[model samples]
Target: MSNPLRLVLFDVDGTLVDSQGSIVSAMTASFSALSLDAPSRDAILSIVGLSLPQAMQNLAPQQSVANQTRLVDEYKQAYHAQRLAQGAASSPLYPGARDVLEELHAQPETLLGVATGKSQRGLDALVEAHGLERFFITRQVADHHPSKPHPSMIQAALSETGVAEQHAVMIGDTRFDMDMAAAAGIASIGVSWGYHDVSALNSATAVIEDFAQLSPALAQLWDK
Candidate 1:
């Protein structure tokens, strides 16, 4: 396992789990609570990787800042409440996600972790519910640092795992994820099965179709 990848940082939502329906439902509930128009499912799905504040900005740009704050607060509450009842049902992993992670975990030199916009509490719940807590050696949640496109979260994961930037790679389903990796001067692999399409992942060093492709992708990265 020498010369192996030191760290692999993952994005949670679209990359590992498909929580689109739950997200849209929660957004709708929040909008209803505020008497505002709920964004369409497709629209909500498009902003899956962003922080709640950022998502709110994209969904209701015309709304005043005060209103946006209020709406986002309501959205978080609704989402958390619904998640408590449904547990992992609302955010099931994509096919092969668990297997892929398990395979990655088998590598002695690789330290698996997450960099997500979800709050630490929310991320902990999801990981524990899905039995994924055992796989990650570290986790960088939203409140741990500034939002994505910022490298702080990734930086934190590297520092905690003792993995240098050059020895790490990021895997996610969005341009934001790729951008963040690029900003950190680390390689990134984008997945087509996530929220963003291929074109959106063009900036990534590699683009994979599914979890089965991840090992080969990492092999290629090592070759470089």
Candidate 2:
């Protein structure tokens, strides 16, 4: 196979799907199961891009490590149950996400990957549900790698896809994504439509307002 001109890694939650509702609801359920109050919506959103344990730790730093571990486990169970109750399609893809991915995937020189905080099981379900499994050739999830802001996920995707750090771009909605890209010595794009405020995306190489802007931005990045 010929070398890819670039590898594009995407974050699943705020970047592709509007999963705030499902996440908030699931976190609420997890807290309730422990007979504790759920964190506020803002608090939940703040940690959306981190792995479960990391997120739970930030949300309840006062809790014992044992309790934090329990919360993480409960959050998974509660999230799964909530997703089942809401039907398997609890979150919808952001408008134009499919089109943008389709267009990029068709570019023979570009490879697609996913570097997300979601577990592999969760990523599998999400991709299958959206029929987007075809677009990605590599997927790095929280189950197998350290959480965002860590370069493990990005580096793993680069290694698996045989794409050098210089030829990869990480697209996400949070500082975690940007920091990860920076740590991996790659570029990052932040989308404004996600849970995080635009100001938080200052670390990004580029911040796009919509999916339509992605193609042009990518083209510019590649040519630079």
Candidate 3:
């Protein structure tokens, strides 16, 4: 019989790409445009995996819903403008990221997908730009479904891919990812190379320091 663990879900922003700096810059620019306080880098980094509106809410809790909406709009505008101006050059993959995905793709029993807070357009642009499209069979973008900490997106991935929760694993860089995976009743593997610190992802089933360690770490999963 085949191994039950057949599906591997990934989180995009921090896990697959180092987009923290670009994200922070865009957020800061948005705040500046609105004459609001730009959150510290640490504060923005802490909320990496949340949906845009949710992130805005977290960053500016005292603001009214209308204000939050305005912030999110401004943030997206600035982010898009920067991407266009710079040819979307921000956020390259971490070391060995491509190799890890290639290796994972080589496994016949394994299927890959993504669950990210980025909008579909943004995610598509990034995936295409990096030539990472071949690895992901399905992508669950933020606006396409419910945000992280909610099981809807993960559920969509599982349903679309025909992967069972017990036989799949979610890999990400935040507690939001872990929490979502746990809520979906699946195993989670966290990466330390992302926005969240190692301690933040400590609750994950496994924490990998880099993509080079991913294969062996995943192998150990089924060995247990």
Q: Could you list the CA RMSD of all candidates, in the order they appear?
A: 1.4, 1.6, 1.2
Between the candidate structures 1 and 2, which one is better when assessed by lDDT?
A: 2
Global lDDT scores for all candidate models: 0.89, 0.90, 0.88
Cα TM-score per model = 0.96, 0.96, 0.96
- Model 3 lDDT-worst window of ten: 82-91
List candidate 2 segments past 4 Å from native. Answer: 1-4
Candidate closest to the true structure, highest lDDT: 2
lDDT tens digits by residue: candidate 2, 119-149 = 9888898888788878999999999888889
Clashing residue pairs in candidate 3 are: none
Give a tens-digit lDDT track for model 3, residues 1-224.
76664889999889998888789999999899889889999999998889999998899999999989999999898878877776546877888988889998999889999999999888988888888878999899899777788988899999999988877889999999998999898889999888888887766999988888888988888677
Cand. 1 TM to true fold? 0.96
In candidate 3, clashing pairs total: 0
lDDT by residue (tens digit), candidate 1, 63-141: 9999899988998898899899999998999999999999989988889999998888889999998999789999998
Better of 2 and 3 by lDDT: 2
